[model samples]
Target: MNVPAAPHSVQPVRLRISYRSPESLLQAFTKSVGKGGVSLPSQRPLARGTRFLFELTAEAVAHPVEVLGEVVDVRRSASGEYFLNIKYVPGRSRKGLDAALLKLFEAHRHEKSRRYPRVPVHLKAQGTTQVWSVRDLSRGGAGVELETGELPKDARLGVPVLLELQLDTGRLMLHGAAVWLTGGTSRPKTPPALGVEFGRLGLETLRALDRVLVLDGFPAGPWQAELTFGMDAVGRMP
Candidate 1:
């Protein structure tokens, strides 16, 4: 007699989260997994145990993720900002959320170890007739400050931009895209600024940037590893 074959076990789906900051990753995990809650800055008062829904959006991710949460606690900051601590509700999305958080955390650890270090700078750059101040620079990107309403009307995450910098050696034009933004009501402590991630660099531009960085006290050498984990994490998200 033929023996019966064993049934295959079905694997659960995993959630993919785009790489951002550790703080953002933590908040996403707490909101998605429902084990803990994230604090939000709001002026509106919410009673304990009040349920609500929050949408999480990111540039790397294609679509927004919705999470259900219940208010756990409330407090007022010295700056008069009201904060609400929320706890996530258990749901079908929990499994994917857990997996995504784990992957993001792992990616974060690798990023901290392999990423290029940034050096402080006070360089001026011109972008499409607009002037900006470069606050920090690294092999991967630069942090630039924008004056009041200096951001382009069409500028958004991942929008291509060309910046011309006046270096001691010569003027260099760098092609990049806006990766992050800070300021406004979200981040009062940080002045309005944009994080620009440079695109594939030509030999001439690389040499020029390296020369500038070396003079700014960055050791003249290549970073250990590429930032692949962060990018890979985005693809793995569901």
Candidate 2:
């Protein structure tokens, strides 16, 4: 959920999230939205960068009036429930998330509700000539399975790549740059995953990212999992 426009512009909020995924789904419960903070208990441990879709009540709504927020903290309790602390968008989303939300109400402008299910899809990355596969996809970016080979780490990250995504309903093609790479054959090892940011995104894709990042919950994955944090997408993580 992108932050709604608001008058009192603040800084971008860095929200931590506990998201339900195509795999692990979290049951809903109630807790405090703001004022002080919030927490959750877990029988099992939740990964850092775990994402969740939060439903906000009227009181939880800040100036933006949108209840959506991101989880910042995930702690394990002896009792077992995972504890979560979320910072709202005005503080995190666009950084200026607060100011933008108010703008909506002031303009009497109604933005269409943008929502796209995070359908776990595959992206095949073909370089300006090389070949890769999308481990998964979200709007802002994608997680891709890289070609196995020996290349300088810098070269791998700097490469411009194209992604061909096969959606449940259709196919979407896009381009992005690898900001970071993960997974080395060993530890202090390179993690078996890489972080990618979108080099180019269509309007629908951008909107899709907003909804998935803000509201959708990412459950655990079957493969080696790395909790995708922020907006970067990288998968098949070891």
Global lDDT of each candidate: 0.52, 0.39
Give the per-residue lDDT digits (tens) of candidate 2, residues 13-94: 2233332322111111111221223454444444444433343222222322133444566666666555655443332233
Candidate 1, pairs of clashing residues: 16-237, 16-238, 37-86
lDDT tens readout by residue for model 1, 5-38: 2222232112234536433543443323422356
The estimated TM-scores of all candidates read: 0.40, 0.31
Best by lDDT: 1
Which stretches in model 1 have alpha-carbon errors above 4 Å? 1-114, 127-130, 185-189, 216-238
Positional deviation of residue 120's Cα in model 2 after best superposition, in angstroms: 7.4
